[model samples]
Target: MIKLKGIVAAVATVSALGSSAVFAQDVEKVIEARQSFMQLYSFNLGLVGEMAKGNTEYDPEIAASAAQNLLALAKMNNSQMWPEGSSKADAGLDEMTRALPEMWSTFPKVLEKQDALTSALENFATVAGKDLDSLRGGMKAVGDGCKGCHTDFRAKKEEG
Candidate 1:
């Protein structure tokens, strides 16, 4: 009976440790998702500015639809994007993610900066249908918002 009790206790300890590690990994995944989601959001929205400026010379229908899609994506909630261990502090950033660990260290400031990004998106929505000349200022604002978050929070893109 004593030996059986000892074995059970040992197994329980190992099981608990395993569960803890899994939880940590899950958290990390959430954080990574948040980073990637933001990148995707920015990359797609950038197309709107490019098309508006005639840089890509896209079809008007395609351009307008894509721009609207971008606007909708920008307003997404994305809470699920940040999992338990996803902070840059938990794991170092990857090649494409410029997020610095300090993003997690200073929480509210990052949130405020993120809110600025939303404002840029909303502003971009207003200018999406306009010509490049009309959109330039909004484009700059959106671009600056992206750079602002990335400069400290996100990692630079990895060159191929």
Candidate 2:
């Protein structure tokens, strides 16, 4: 009976460890998805930014498409990508993500930031394809919105 009890205890411990390993993998996947989402944002923003900078010829159609894409992305429900234990402060996440702990600790502040970005994107979409001057003006608000959130919630990249 004692031997059987010991075996049962060992199995429970192993089972717990296995579940932890799975949880860690899940967190990693969530982080990857979040990074991918950011990459998409960067890609679409770059399309408009390059044109606004005069580095790329301002194609109205492309500008409108990219602006609309930004608005669509801003409206996406991506809460799952921000699971609680996935910040840079968490174990094994420090190098994988630049998300500050305050992003979670500050609660609705993040939502406010997101809303600000959404509003900027909505306005930008309306003016982006109108002309070069309008795109430049709209870009300023969009850039400010992104910077506001990053300043408060994202950690600076290490200069390795």
Candidate 3:
């Protein structure tokens, strides 16, 4: 009877540890997915920005392709990456994400920012391929739209 009880207790401990491991992996996946999505945004944005800065030759085809990709990404539904308990303040996941608890607390303000991004992206998609001057002119609204959200919803990065 004593040996049987010891085996049962050991199994229970292992089971509990397994559950914790699964939870940690799930949160890590969520963090990675969101980060990947943000990278896509940056990748497309960089193409236009480099051209705007005159570092890259202003090619209409490349600008249109990049702007179209940015528009698609802006319209992607990312609700799964932002599950309620996944904020930076969540236990055991604090270091995995920079999303703030206030992002949820602020409610429709977040939605407003998203809408602004969509609007700017739509404008960019329409004008990006027209000419260099058109892309330059459209860039300010897009930058402002991005800043409006980042300033409110994201935590500021600590400079080295």
Candidate 4:
């Protein structure tokens, strides 16, 4: 009976370890997904930013498309990708993510920032296709919305 009880205990321990490993993998996937999402934002924003800066020719159609894409991405429901244990402060995540713990701890403040970005994107989309001057006029608010969130919720990149 004692041997049987010891075997059951060992099985439980193994099961617990297996679950922990799975959880860690899930967190890693979430972090990767989050990074990919941010990259998409950067790609779309860069399209409009370059035109606004006159570094790229301001093609109205492309500007409109990129602005629309940015708005669409901003409106996506990506809550699952930001699960609580996925911040850089969590074990094994420091090297994989730059998300600050304050993002979760500060709660609805992040949501407010997201709303601000969405609002800016909505306005930018309206003017982005019109002309270079219109795009330039609306760009600062959109950029500020992004910067505000990053300033509060993201950690600085490590200097390596």
Give TM-scores for every candidate, taking all chains together and pairing residue i with residue i. 0.70, 0.91, 0.86, 0.91
Task: Give model 2's TM-score versus the native structure.
Answer: 0.91
Clashing residue pairs for model 4:
none
What local lDDT does model 2 show for residue 9?
A: 100
lDDT of 4 by residue, 1-160 (tens): 9999999999999999999899999888888898999999999999999998889999999999999999999999999999998888998889999999999998989999999999999999999999999999999999999999999999999998
lDDT of 2 by residue, 1-160 (tens): 9999999999999998999899889998998998899899899999999999999999999999999999999999999999898899998789989999999999989999999999999999999999999999999889988899999999998997
Q: Kindly indicate the candidate among 3 and 4 with the higher lDDT.
A: 4
lDDT of 3 at 156: 79
Ranking by lDDT: 4, 2, 3, 1
**Cα deviation of 142, candidate 1, in Å:** 0.5
| Candidate 3 local distance difference test against the native | 0.90
Model 4 has an lDDT value of: 0.95
- Candidate 4 residues lying further than 4 Å off, grouped into runs, are 1-13
State how far residue 74 of model 1 sits from its true place (Å).
2.7
Output the lDDT of residue 106, model 4: 87
- The 10 consecutive residues of candidate 3 with the worst lDDT sum are 86-95
Report the error of model 3 at residue 21, Å: 3.0
RMSD of each: 4.1, 2.1, 3.3, 2.0
Worst 10 residues of 4 by lDDT: 85-94
